[model samples]
Target: MSAADDRLAARVRALAAAVEAAEGRSDAAVSADARAVVERAGERVAFSGSYTVVALAGATGSGKSSLFNAVTGTELARVAVRRPTTAKPMAVSWGSELPHALLDWLDVTGRHLVPSGPHELSDLVLLDLPDHDSTEVSHRLTVDRLVELVDALIWVVDPQKYADAALHEGYLKRLAPYADVMMVVLNQADRLTPEELDRCLGDLRRLLDAEGLRATPIMAVSALRGTGIKELREALARTVANKQAMTRRLSADVTVAATALAADLGTANVPRVDERLQRQVVAGLGAAAGVPIAVDGVRRAWRKRGTVATGWPFVTWLARLRPDPLKRLRLDLTPGDHSPTEVNRTSLPKASAVQRARADQGLRELTDAATSGLPRGWASAVRNAAGDRRAVLLDRLDVAIAGTDLEVRRGTWWWGLFGVLQWLLIAAVVVGAVWLLANPLLLGLGLPQLPPVLWYGVPAGTWLLVGGVLAGLLLGVLGRALVEIGANAHARDARRSLEDAVRAVVTEEVFEPVEAELARYRLARQQVAEAART
Candidate 1:
């Protein structure tokens, strides 16, 4: 392939990539049209650019077949007066090798090779296409298809129908973007006088200007009388020699395809997920996961466990009789050992309808916010991405919560100290009770009497008993207050830990997928923009 062909092929490939990226996310009609353009252009570019392919397109009875025969110097295409003569396309190749591959791609079976002649215009393949306005549907369809594939368009118009709306509005106006590869010819010019010819040519130029085809070349020719065939031949020779018609035509196709898809790529910036949306998602998931109830369980469990460790020895057993709050909820309140043990499921209730609705609403709001400036189809795609895995969302969140280590089992330094103090008090009470009982037993046995010792006007044995009882009760009260304070702080920390776990799940399951889609859109838009430039 030539450098020019490679460049054209690159542009076509880029367009094809963009269209594929947008296939399910854009308007079906627009994407289909773009895909067709890429396919047709690929087929056309595969053939060598040794010759130029020009088509003579016009309405029925516009003398196009006559001009085709005149150009080829033979009666190749059938010229008739029965309304529509050419039903299918006829091709005439001069001097250059036959482009069988190209003709096969064009589906043109009616082909002829011109006899050896002046090699000035040898590298030209002229096609006589079906009438654009034929009453037969197939003829018009064939014309429409060939017009897009040909390298250059030579519209053959007669003086009588030069101003026809079908010629100007249907073909010329729509083909304004391809003016570089387009030409207009007034055929059968022998019938008009010099003044009439000039006036007609001037009026045609004005009409072409109105159709945005001001740069298109115009010529006066008579295929039958051969008045201006030489000029037309010279023009064809110049175009074939340049060999840029194929490149120009392909470039124009890319531009048109890109324009059709412009609506889908309205803005360059991809939408982003805001902090508010992230917070809302976390809140909803937390609610669905019963985070509040779990935190409360942590608090209650800490208090009960702490009481067993530091409560007065007399009633510490009572505390063990009641069920552990965290255990009942099926949670391990113990600090994580970082082992590979299986995580326990929480007995929290399933999310109610109201909770589910709130979560769904938050997801919708996130989608809307992220896709605010995107096209409708792209916005819809993003919204669909957000909800694509919604059925599995709650299950995933529950797993995340269960895997979290709430650090509820972490013990405070004061807890151990209080435990030791409680044990010492129990020992003191035991020792003092033994002393009081032994004193009475010794007196009853009539042993030798001993002097009585007193503290603050009480006997020594009585002092020991009363002090132990009062001090142990006071220490128990202080330990209970400390346990309450520690439990409250622990609950707050557990709630934070659960929230962090829930946030991570939301990011993985929801935000990442949506961002990935936006990244795809960004890449597609970039490809389309580059293709358009080419």
Candidate 2:
């Protein structure tokens, strides 16, 4: 085989693999034709090495059977005996043995071999197909089947019907991609004068070119007169001798499959999962997972802890009676904190109907974006797969919320300092109270009356008690202001972390599958391009 032929075979193999992968990931309708090509290519290549199958195809009265006999120089195919109603193809090969296996695959039952003689037509399996324009439905179907399987096609037409609508519009227009393996024969040329033949050939060439078969070879021959018979034989010999007929035919099939597959692939690139998209999805999931409630828990828990540490020292003990906001909501426990006996589910309330609706909309938007520019069939498949993704979302969100660390430790650094200062002020008040009581006890016991220490024209005991009271009140007010600031800070932090966790969940449960499908799509396109390459 030539280097070009080897390259084509390798490409066809790669194309087959790519088509198979696409079928598994794609909708059946989108991939049906391309997959059929892949199947046909595999079967055709196995028999391609032995003989090149060149089929004679034409309308009912095109003298196609006569041309087949003229090229092979034999009456191997009974043109006079075959009826227009015959659907079975007559295969005439010059091989030593009848090509039974190959014909079986082609579903051909009638076969013959030319007697050993000059072997110019050897290495060729020539088929005289049934009339494509036959009145019989089965005959037409048979032509269609063989058309797909043949390695090369020789379309015969008489000067009178060379421009027939059924042959040109119905077949040639669609077969344009297989131009390399196809040729048009203007048969019965003996009926036309030299000038008439030139005009007719020109018209035929124009029509074929208009149908995108500009490179398709055209010949004017008379099978009965043996006109241009030897040249046609030489062309057939070259097609057989180069051993590239099968490769060319399969390559054209690849082109046809790739072109069809490209329709479903659309002219768009894959969509991405950006930060903005993630944030949108996370917002919805956070609502469904009680993110607002979780943030509120963080704020309240921060203030609750702060109250005990910085409230009036005498009254702060009462603050301990309040429940911890995080503990009550079970947001304080990370997933790793769970023991073997603990359940994985959190104590957060179930999402309300409104929140659930919001989440579903978000997930739907994701799939919509993923399939934005894709064709209907592929988009439909991706959406169906997204249904399975949606099933696990609620469970995934629950785990995400449970796994987030909602504790606020950085908000409590000054709490100890405030508490110690409050206690020092309390000691001053206690000292003042003791001094006042000592005076009463000493006077009653007839001891010497203590001289009162004065400060700013007031009794020292009164100043000590009053000043401590004023300072402690001022400090308590300042502490409450600080607690509010810290609570807001902690609330924002918890929201960020929870949103981040929710983002991770959606990426795994939602976007991963979509990306996998996108990768498959890219692979299909790449493979098709390779298969369609020359």
Candidate 3:
């Protein structure tokens, strides 16, 4: 392919991708019409490029077939007085071998090859299309279909219906974008007086101007009287010579398709998943996954384990009597053992209706934040994407929370030192008590008198009993205070870890899908912009 052909093909492919991207998200009719344009243009571009396909289109009783015959200098199409005479299209090819593939693609069965003539119009394949305003729906349908495929259109109008609303409003205005490749011919001009013909041509020009077709050429032609036929043939010869009709027509098609889809590409500003939105998502998921309750459980469990480790040895049994809070929640007491099977369902309560509603609202807010500047259609698509798997969101979140390894083990060195000290103090107090109790037994057995120990002028036995008991109580109280503080810090850390895990789930389950949709929209916008550019 040449550079121009490669460019056009690339554009067509871009347009096709845009249409595919918009299939389910955009209006069905708009997407279908764009798809049709892409398909038809692709077929035309791939076929023979040597000939230009020009169609003579008009309403009923406009002498379109007569103009067709006059231009080709052969009676190719059957002209009749009956309304809507040409039910099917007839083609007249000039100068070269018949483009059978092109004609077949156009579905024009009636073909005529004209001998080479003086007009130098050898590269033209002129078609006489059915009346666009025919009472028969099929004829109008045929006209609509062929008009889209033709390389250039010569709209044949008669003075009687030159300014008719049906012709101007239905065909001319809709095709205004193709003005560069369109022409208006006032057929049967010989029937009017010269003065009347001039007035009618001027009025037709004004009407075309109103329809936004000011650049489209208009000429007066009479197929029967042969007036102004040369000018029409010359105009067509120029079109065939330039060989840009196909490109112009295809470009116009792209414009129309892109314009139809412009509403969907609301803004060039791409939507983003920002940190604030991600935080909102994490917060919501945290609530739904019951992170607060789990964190609280971890804190209580930490304190319980700390009491067992650092409390006075005799009273520490009381702490052991209570179940470990983390164990009750099915959380691992040890850190870093994160086997999937080791984790179990948490005893944390299910999310209440209020919490679930808050979570849902948070998700909606995140969606709104991400799609803030987008068009309504695109915003709706993004929101829908976020909620696509909403039914399973809670289950996934629960599993994520369960799988998170919250570091809740209480293995501090200070606690172990405090535990040994508590044990040594308890031993001192027990030994002193036993020594005092055995005094009576020693007297009853008539044993020798025990030596009295003294410390700072007081008996060492009394000092051991009072000092050990008091110090043990003080150490236990201080250790409990330290454990409480440490537990709170641990709880905070665990909460943060759980939130991070939930955020990961939110990103994977919600934000990722929404982001993917936004990416698609961005790609589609880029492709459309490229295809629509000149």
Q: Best candidate, TM-score-wise?
A: 3
**Mind giving the per-residue lDDT tens digits that candidate 3 earns over 1-534?**
556667777888888988877767777788888899899887998885778999999988889988888888887778776744788989998864678999999999988887766447887899999888878898898898899899999999998888888888888899999999999998988899999998998888888898899989999888988988888888888998888889889988988897777666765588687887688778877887789888999889888888889887778898899987777776763444446566456667888998888888888888877788876667788988899888888777777777787776546889989999998998889887776666677889998757777789887777778888999999999999999998999999899889888888878889889988888888888888878776
Predicted candidate 2 versus true structure: per-residue lDDT over 379-479, tens digit per residue: 76677656666767877888788778776744466988998988888888887777777889999999987888888888788876877777887888889
**Which regions of candidate 3 fall more than 4 Å away from where they truly are?**
1-7, 81-84, 115-119, 267-274, 333-343, 371-374
> TM-scores of the models, in the given order?
0.91, 0.82, 0.92
Output the lDDT of residue 142, model 2.
Answer: 94
Worst 10 residues of 2 by lDDT: 78-87
Writing each residue's lDDT as its tens digit, candidate 1 over 1-534 gives 578777877888889989988878888888888898898887776774587899999888789998988888898778777754688999989863577888888889898887666687676888999989888899999999899899999999999999999888889999999998999999989989999999999999999998889889899999989988989998998999888998899889988988888666786478888899989988987897788888999999989888878788798899999998776776664435334675556777899999888888899889988898888888888988888888888888787777788777667788889889888878788777777787677889988555667777887767667777888788888888999998999999999999999988888888888888788788779878877876
Name the better of 1 and 2 by TM-score. Answer: 1
Q: What is the lDDT of every predicted structure here? A: 0.85, 0.81, 0.84
Order of all candidates by TM-score, from best down to worst?
Answer: 3, 1, 2
User: What root-mean-square deviation over C-alphas does model 3 reach?
Assistant: 2.7
TM-score of 2: 0.82
